[model samples]
Structure formats: C-alpha cells, structure tokens
Target: MSTPILEFATDANNPCMHCGVCCTHFRISFYWAEADDAPSGWVPASLTEPLNPWLRCMKGTNGKTRRCIALTGTVGQAVRCAIYSQRPSPCREFPVYLEDGRPNPKCNELRAQVGLPPLPELPIAPANDPDGTPTEPPTEPPAAA
Candidate 1:
C-alpha cells in the first residue's frame, strides 16, 4: 500500500514545502533502461507506459492530467512520491530552483498554471537545498494571498 507522507514540517526556512504543482504539470518520460529491472533506480514498469521503444513515461503523466502515477496525497497540501527512492532520472533532475538560489523558470511557470505563486528567486527554502531545490516536494501551498 502507498503510505501517504501525510504531513511535512513547515517553517520559516521553506516556502515551497506544501505545493506539488510540477508533478502534474509535465510529461515525466525517461529512458526505458531506467526501470526497476535495470541496473539502478527502480521505477516500476507497471506504472509506466511506452512513449517510444526507447522511452517510457510515468502512467498518469502521459495522460491529460499529467500527474505522476506514484504521487500520493493532495496537490496543494501534502503529497509524496510512492516510489520516491526508485523514481526515474527526469524526476531526480527536475530542479525547483537554480544552483545559485534562483527559482527555476519552469517550476515557477508550472506553479503559476495551478494558481500557486512563483517561488522566489532568493531565499526559497534554502536550508539543506544542495542543488537549489528542496530534498522533498513542497508540502503546502503558500497561505492564501
């Protein structure tokens, strides 16, 4: 069973901890070799659909909603990736922010599409964000404006 991550610790250090707009905003496709049966990270084949012989995409992401098949819980509140440790390379590489603490343009664009505000270019949950992104997906949307 997929245990929802349930809740995240929100604080002054992280602004994006509660938002999950990007997981439903893009096509999460990756090389077929990235599947569980391969040499490394284990995205399950059953939760994916072939995009091409060389590429497979997370099931929900290839559809109209674009939500990843492994994503759990609500989008603007708490959410988790059911197969987080085994997620494919594309997910592992999608940055919420740039290396210098600027918000990723694509991330902000996706958030805007969902009525979530743009992640700030500076001071966006910087603690433990080695690559300018949160280690976990955002856990809550910004408080109502």
Candidate 2:
C-alpha cells in the first residue's frame, strides 16, 4: 500500500529547523511537465538536467554530499529553500511526522547525519466517520494521584 499523505503543521514544539537534509541528500526528480508548469525563471531550464525527454530532475544532486542548487544558507545553521513556495511536489510531500506517528526513515537518517535526534512519532489523529463526525466522543484524562 502507498504511504499516507501527511499534513505539515508548524508548531512551537516541532523539532525541524533549517536542517537541509532533504534538500541536500536526495535526487529530486520529477516529470518534465512539472518544469513546464513552474513560473518563468523559477526553476530555470538550465539548472535542470533531463533524466529523459519526458522527465527532468534538478541538478546539483549527482553526489551523496551535494546540495540542491536552490538551497541557501548553511546546512544546520540557518538554511532555507530558495523556492519553498514553488518547490516540486516531491519537496512538498516530504513528511514531518508527529510524536505518535510512523517515522520517515529517510528523513530521520538525514537528521542523524546532522547530529540531530530522530523525530518523535507523530500522534494519531482521532478517526472520523463517513459523514465527518468523530468516531468517538472526547474524553478527559483520569484524575492524577
């Protein structure tokens, strides 16, 4: 089965911060159609090397240690994605799991490489019914001793 689609929520308690692991550690390739949809001068044609006539991937990821051309600032210091709003679908879909949820191993590996701890499991959201009602009523915790 395919992985579940994860939602990105910025929380004060969240651990992610300019880690740049995903941007520098993986080959982010996608269909040629994606490049065409990118705004003029956003994802420059020259910066993308063709994986095939129908596919193209961003350059600068040929080696394991190479960083993406769009990455700016230091890897673990204060990095940022130059094209965050216009990043490819792959970038948008990179999971940042919650404290009780399943792990994204690749993401955790990158974190480990940078001397950061693995992300805590994501908390499972409460289930909803077909009509969007909560499957069970909310309950308060038992009284503390």
The sequence of per-residue lDDT tens digits that candidate 1 reaches over residues 22-130 is 6787888899988876687388989888898899988888877678878887776566677876878877677665655566787767666656677654443466454
Top TM-score prediction, candidate number? 1
lDDT of 2 at 72: 81
For candidate 2, lDDT tens digit of each residue in 1-98?
01124433431233334467777778887777677454543455666778878777778876666788888877754566666665666776776552
Clashing pairs in 1: 17-138, 17-139, 17-140, 18-138, 18-139, 18-140
Clashing pairs in 2: 98-121, 98-122, 99-121, 99-122, 100-121, 100-122, 100-123, 101-121, 101-122
Tell me the whole-model lDDT of each prediction, alpha carbons only.
0.65, 0.58
Error of 2 at 137 (Å): 21
Candidate 2 lowest-lDDT run of ten: 136-145
